[model samples]
Target: MFRAREYKICIIGDSGVGKSCLITYFLTQKFDSNNKVTVGGAYHEKQLFINNEPLHLQIWDTAGQERFRSMTPMYYRNADLIILAYSINSQKSFSNLPGWLLDVQKYHDGDPILSVVGNKSDLEKYRKVETKEGKEYAQSIDATFFEVSAKSGTGISEMFGKIAYQVAETRDRAKQNKTGYINPESQTETNKKGCC
Candidate 1:
């Protein structure tokens, strides 16, 4: 009788920052060299297991172009997590992070889990944005940060694993709060009876 939960995750960043590529690689485990840009937004899902409980991740890959900025909010509504991606090789992409963060805050209802991802980690040789700078910026905003290479499939599993665990914890807490269950002993029993 295990209950399944679904979490919505959104990715936002400047164009050519590899937002689409990251999602594509995560979903299919194959990188597209053509670099097809996302138009408005795209939705994808993956069924994951956290602590033996099923969790469905509804991932939204938003367009990074300015023309699609206005519609981005629609895709991020009710998102449990938001990933701010930037190319490590592009300083301009990193510089535009403030505006992107503002946009997410302006539209999302509450404090969703914000993750700062430095994409294109495989291009470290040409990197303009240092790892320290990206980490510091993420720290400044109190967001989780990871340097990942969608092209090389590096750090992808760890990042997604962290997201799944976090979102599951949030859901578990919400469920407990809604039922006013504060006793840890009873809570453990309730969880064992198939709540996740």
Candidate 2:
């Protein structure tokens, strides 16, 4: 029997950054141009198979309006992974990323994986933020960077696949450390159990 493990994730950024659209596209594989502004927040669940192991992702999409800013951090608490999305055409959204990152740093103590997503890659012709700039900023903050399009369905699957694998790896490492399981790759001692 396969046991399903649940991982909590949160999406956050300034308003109009396509946070909701990205989630919608990921779940439905279709983008709704008329998606209503997400108030307070919304929850979504997706089941996936990672290395033949059942996995559940509890995705939380938060409102980006200024009025909802104060309430957003509460949802981010205890998240397993946080997707910080910004529009490639909106310099303001990209500029505000640091503040959002700081908010995550304030609320999350477990060091959840941070993914800085440059959304709206379909509108690259109108992009104000350069790809290199986003990559450099993500690197500076020690986070993974992805340029994805909720519209064209470009780079979405690859990004999520990487996220799922990374979360699984983090969980496995935590479990091993907790049980004092020595990883043979880093072990010099003989007769040590090898990493599975």
Candidate 3:
């Protein structure tokens, strides 16, 4: 028998950074070069194992256009993990990350478990966001960073795997504390009964 754990992840970034493409590649293991801009939001699900435990991940892909920004906070509120996407070829997209981060902070209380993805890595010839710069920015905010090409299936698995591990770890810690508290209380009750 297998028990499946469910997790919710949200993707955010500027338009044209290929946020939808990354989710497609990870879930379907295939990429569409002609993918269109996401209108409001889309969701995809995939089942995988993290440390031998079954995990069902529901990924929410949000529209990166300016018009959709107002509706984004509702999506962020329930996210267990977040992926901040950027395109290396577009300087504007890269520069807009700070604003995106701020939105996440404001809506999500600045959760620490975030992955910073520099997408469209296949176009490295036209890259403007240097690898060091992306890494530095991620470090400053305590996020894991990766350079990925959703079109080429680069770093897609690794990024999701890291997020899964972080989620699992957080869940495990919570479970341990719950168990520890209950066990001690039961033991105290047994000792009191014996004394009476």
Candidate 4:
């Protein structure tokens, strides 16, 4: 039995960290050597099958500049998953992730699943954010971390897979809650009342 699920995800990080490049690479599989800095944000959609079930994902790639920060909360509110991207070559980008996470926590209702991506792995020579530090910070915030190179298409598929898995899990939990099996007391109360 194959069911289709829809997921909404957002990519947020500091400016010039290749957030747009990552999206372009994942969806189009083509990298722009002269990719322009995203002004506000960009959107992309991709579909995949998980356990033979079709899953459609809508991804929002947000700008990382301070001027654009105020508009981020609106997008974060509706996201099922959030990806905080940073460049391995830029320490400032990595350092700014905590503030971004804080924004998500403050504006979003529930605790959303997050993934931290240290992009530009192809430029290992200029790497600034240590893998151990990145992973540790991700762990501190309960986020999954991966080092990826949008240029080489490294780890993009796995990143999306993680997002899909989280979405599937969330959907399954929601389904259980809707069926009332997850909350027996609520189910009992509802069943006691007349059909309405």
Candidate 5:
């Protein structure tokens, strides 16, 4: 019998970096243009399948405003993946990544999978953070790098799916190490909910 597993994910970044929109788009495949600033945090879930086994992704969209910074480390305590986001059009957002990284390093109990995500790919014309800069930063931090657009729903699937797979395999090394590894591409259910 295949056992079900739950994974925790936390998305953190500066305010107005499109963190909430990314979660909304991933769960619904629709752009949420009316998304407001996340006050403290919002939780969401998606049921996914990996190698035919059930997996539950418990996601948290944390508030990016400076005032909420002190409250964020608690969410980082037990995460399987942490997405550090920045708006491509906002250099300030990108520049603040190290501060966010410091929070994770100082508080995260386990070594979670990290991803540096550049949001607002749809606003490429107004881009302030170059692709090379993002890539180099990700490399320096030893994290996977991706560029996504919540409005256009681009690059979300590949980025999340790949990271989820890596986390799953790592978490179940003994079971999954039996050889003939199958690339279990993600299949998700759109269950609407929130947690904070």
Candidate 6:
């Protein structure tokens, strides 16, 4: 049996970490040079095909300003993935990654897949955070790390695709455990729809 799968993802970071640009480029495959800052938050989604099955992504972009910090928790509910993004050119953004990670851990329920992203990779010359540092941080937290260039649309699809697969696999394991089934293939398919 195969059915549609949907995952809600929340993106958080400092004001100019390019969170909105990452979502925009992921959905449209084009960059918006004149992109405006997200005030409270923004919601966008797109239907993607993974392994020949439809996988829907609900992406929530939260404002990074101090005023919006309180509201960030509201979007974390029922989220399957939380992406902590930092700009490669902004040392402050990179420095603030742990704060954002703590915010999500404090507010979000259960366990969700966490991804650490270093955005604006195209500005390599102006990089302030080393890739090794980002990778180390992600490893310390048991999260995935990605360096993406939203402006050039580099590493966007691959990031999302891998995250989607990882989320689905995690969900499948949880579901299987609930059914007291060790082998996923042996699980009943009456209400199921897709393969992980």
TM-score-wise, the better of 1 and 6 is 6
- Residues forming the 10-long window of minimal summed lDDT in candidate 6: 186-195
Candidate with the greatest lDDT versus the true structure: 6
TM-score of 2: 0.90
lDDT of model number 4: 0.83
Stretches of candidate 3 off by over 4 Å are 109-112, 178-196
Lowest summed lDDT window (length 10), candidate 3: 187-196
In model 4, which runs have C-alpha deviations exceeding 4 angstroms? Answer: 1-3, 177-196
How far residue 7's Cα lies from its native spot in candidate 3, in Å, is: 0.9
Per-residue lDDT of candidate 3, residues 1-196 (tens digit): 9579888889999999999999999888899888888878888888877655578888899999999889888887778888889999998998999999889888886454788899999998999999999999999988889999999999888878777767766665566788764334323544333211
lDDT of 6 by residue, 63-121 (tens): 99999889888987679999999999999999998998888888888788899999999
Candidate 5 lDDT, tens digit per residue, 78-167?
998999999999999999999999989999987888999999999989999999999999999989999999999999877777777777
Instruction: Work out how many backbone clashes candidate 2 has.
Output: 0
* Tens digits of per-residue lDDT for model 1, 1-196: 8667889999999999999888878888888888688999999998887656689999999999999899999999789999999999999999999999999889898778888999999998999999999999999998889999989989887788787777677666777889987646434644444333
* Tens digits of lDDT, candidate 4, 73-170: 87778888899999999999999888898899899886678889999999999999899999999999888889999999998878877667766666
Candidate 2 pairs with clashing backbones: none
Instruction: Give lDDT tens digits, candidate 2, residues 28-62.
Output: 89988999998989999988776555788899999
The global C-alpha lDDT for each of the candidates, from Candidate 1 onward, is: 0.87, 0.86, 0.83, 0.83, 0.86, 0.88
Model 5 ranges with Cα > 4 A deviation: 174-196
Root-mean-square deviation (CA) per prediction: 3.6, 4.5, 8.7, 7.9, 6.7, 3.9
Clashing pairs in 4: none
In candidate 6, stretches whose alpha carbon ends up further than 4 angstroms from where it belongs are: 1-3, 182-196
lDDT winner, 2 or 6: 6
Worst 10-residue lDDT window, candidate 5:
187-196
Estimate TM-scores for all models: 0.89, 0.90, 0.87, 0.87, 0.86, 0.91
